[model samples]
Target: MSVYNQPRRRVIQMIMIGMILLIVARLFVLQVVEKKYAKLADANAVSRKVVYPSRGIIFDRKGKSILGNDAMYDLVVIPANAKNIDTAYLCQILNIDKEEYKKRMLTAILKNGRVRQSVFAPLLPPEVFGRLQESMYLFQPGFELVQRQIRSYPYAAAASILGYIGEISPQLLDNEAYKAYQMGDYLGLTGLEKTYENVLMGQRGIQYLVKDNLNRPQGPYENGEFDSAAVAGKNLRLSLDIELQVLGENLMKNKIGSIVAIDPTTGGILAMVSSPTFDPNLLTGSYRSANFSRLYQDTTKPLFNRALQARYPPGSTFKPMIALVALDEGVITPSYGYPCGGAYYGCSRPIRCTHSGGGHAANLRLALANSCNSYFSHVYRLSVDAQKFGGIKIGGMQKWADYMHAFGFGHRIGVDVPGENGGLIPDSAFYNRRYKGSWNSCTSVFLGIGQGEVLLTPLQMANAMCIVANKGYYYIPHFVRSIDNDDTDLLAKYKEKHVVAHISDSAYQTVINGMTDVIERGTGRKAAIEGVRVGGKTGTAENKAIINGVLTAQKDHSMFVAFAPADNPKIAIAVVVENAGFGATYAAPIASLMMEKYLKDSIPAKRNPVVKFLLEANTIPPAMQQKSKLDSLNRKAAATLKNGAGGRTFR
Candidate 1:
């Protein structure tokens, strides 16, 4: 009995010793091993703060302010640190409801941990911020009034091109690329802003600041050694001429369509105007909530970038390219001739020639001058028919399409701006999908005349004219000419010549001759400039629309393409007006005005006696109304011709 009791006593003593060792180990962890964690917990009880940097600025080509920053204040609160503060008094001072304050506090707690750090609420007005600052001491320890910068667009114009920045969404914040950005940081949403975000959004910096128990910053920590300086964003000098852009926008007021102007030598976009444009300032700040909703709901879609986004049939403006292909393929010489009687090739689908009294017989030059469909149809068929060429034809519809591709159609031009769509250039794949491999060469005849499945943007159309003006190659169109405060190497990528095709210099000469005739005697005479040789083409594309599930003919789309100083071409332009009768009537006049402004710095007065007479004749007798209409149409047609195509008469 004594031995068993002694063993039990030893067991009890060993258990007590093990318990004492476990307590010692716990005390060691709490006092020594976990000292850093304990220190952090104690520091959090005293103060915590965050610093936000100012956003960058945006400048135009001239270094004039396009977008800049404005000072504002943000309302911030810390749920864990806000204690024993009168809720009613705080709400009154901050100009917020009690419920809103409560909700904000709950949201902050959820977003941030239960730490004493300040959390940002939505942006507040300057007045509200002022009120909060006035009574800031009355609030809890962690409440703060943080000054911040807001985006402001100075010009308010070029909304489509400059685009706007907006707050980052939750999903965007989750993206790896956006990990560094805070939830409320602004991001480029469209246009140049989106395209050059990296260059525009400068590097973010950080610094350490000592704070008091109230969480207010108490100057820099460690003599500012820990601070990192922010790098300002670089500025862009776009090629766009601000004065011309303003002028173009004003001229197109109350109209629907677009106008694009390019410097043929540099591919610099001089002016791009889309009617129904909105002020970009509407999208940049505290006012964005109300203004953006209004802009989004507007029926006209003023936000759309019509110059680069809208696609339309090349119409007769495409004839120049077709003529080039025909001549280059040896399908037809400049001397080729055909009869035009308001139709082409006697096909059942007769094309109505703009010429009066049905149509007249035409040669290649005359055909382009008069815009005769028959001669073009003959060349179009001859250029593409292998069987007609005795199986030796290398210039067919596919070859014509390839030439169009070389002209920068049916593909993206790789402009620096974002949201550029590769306008459709139907290939065998597209045709197979549409017709299931049953389509043939005859099915694509309309493409010869720049219709059916062939689409082009105003920029593409202007580029085509520039290509022709340059006599062959063209630089890829770009907006930024140079970057401000950047080294020359910054533009190395853009300085290289982007040759789309290398047609022989002789081929360009033949096409230029026809284009010259079109301006001197053909369909673009109205686009002529005094003391300056100008070449151009006019197009009147038939409109088809679905009405009650039935396709019907509607108003025509007027279009014109022109280049100034034809002998030494400087500027090339394209203008399109939706539902605007004839190309030579409305479109040609506008193109002529833009060229006059660009070349001579002023519009030339209306000096054509025929046009002046027609203007005055409109006030004449009622019996002359029919004659007046015909005279007006003929004068416009003659102007188009005198600008190049119809001066030589082949009797």
Candidate 2:
């Protein structure tokens, strides 16, 4: 019985030892090595909550808070844990009907599943939050309140520039760029907010809580070791001057236009006012959707950003640029003369001059000051027909287009904002495409006077003024001066200087002198300010719009461009008042007042009447106002916003 029995005993012993080891290993894995099973078992009782970090604070140049945060609460729910809660009572606290409650619940479930937390009701007002806070315990683990920050404007201004934040859309959620963002996250929709979203949206944090059988939160899961802390976004310091912006907006009231003022030294935008603008607060808080729809549908298009996007003929305000180009091209010298006895008879179709006298067209300086339509028309014809570049085909039109591009025309200026429209500057190819090279400089002679196919945004016009002020170069215009704690290469582009034109300083001086005379002795005389030698040009851009399938002549758009202290220019501004009769009537005075307000900080006592007139002037034609509901809607919204903010009455 000996050997066989011993082997069998040994086999049995080894098998028993292996079984014992397996049992010990399994127990160790369940208790320590593999935590997955334990976590799964604890899944029903655990809630992972998102802690949204406060968005970055936006401050004006003077450190005044333009956009700030107000504390709010978002009622989030983990549907899996929402069992015994009183649905009726929860809806009452949330101020929603039963059907709405069901809709939100269904949305939450479909969004991230029943176990994950989803926003039930977001951005509760302080009063609503207070009411809900008192009865929060009744909602238990299924519904918990998470702190959030909604935007608030101290000065309800610059709605277009500041932009607004909104909940992430489904398309954005699926976008690769927004992969890091969750569905309930808020992102900037437009303006500077949209441009600097990455810098403004801080890192989100997460916290885990444990719930009991009744879905009531017991305490923190894993004693809060796994929780992450939220980091507040970086603060942005803008280049905007609060007072200047407010004043510009005020002056633009009851008008349809834009005011773009830039600091020529740095290309920083001091104030950009798109008339018919609404309160920025309208796009914040709970009323954002309704108000946004109203704004989008309004006939006047207050939501449209005119300064950066609206393209219009530069009118006589473009004469200086043409003069500069002509002087630089040697097509016309500073002393070149063109005889114009009220009308330029050189062209087949004689062009009429606004100035009746022929003496003013004797030289470029006098011609520019007078804005002699005949002189500029002659200059344009000569430049395009010059012997060097073959007439309007071989290289003439192309060269002219090149000059325009050098002045920051016909392309994006790379502004640090979203939705910048590059105004059109046509080349020979464009004309050839349309006319098969049949077009001569005479056919497109309107280019000389800033009419025809020429178009420019108020931003481009303002930048052109900056270029003229800076002599030959400019910084790419930007809203934010700098970003706090920024190490990334975000603002590198704005810091670089761009040399658009290389004309000599003397040529610029001659142009400047002409512009100065314009303010002192010519049409822009209304723009002259005492003690400050301002150089400006007044423009009455002809307005023609197609109505009922017929081209109708409308009121001319009033425009003016100016730079102060002529020698060491500080601010360069462009103002456009649509449907106004003449440039001097509305645009020039507004520009003058703005310059005075910025440089002198107050309008002189003598000019108080002018201020009163401008403030009270209703440039918007009554017929247009009657046809379009935009002005009324804007007024009502402004009144509501002013009253709500506890500010002074709508300016």
- TM-score of every model? 0.80, 0.90
lDDT against the true structure, per candidate, is 0.70, 0.86
Clashing pairs in 2: none
The 10-residue segment of model 1 with minimum total lDDT is: 642-651
Candidate 1 yields a Cα-based lDDT of: 0.70
**Candidate maximizing lDDT:** 2
lDDT of 2 by residue, 355-385 (tens): 7755887887788788888888878878877
Model 1: per-residue Cα lDDT over 56-101, one tens digit each = 5555545666667666666666677688877797777667798888
- Model 2, runs deviating above 4 Å: 1-44, 78-84, 107-117, 210-223, 627-651
- The C-alpha stretches of model 1 lying farther than 4 A from their native spots are 1-63, 76-96, 102-123, 137-148, 346-349, 356-361, 387-395, 436-440, 487-491, 604-651
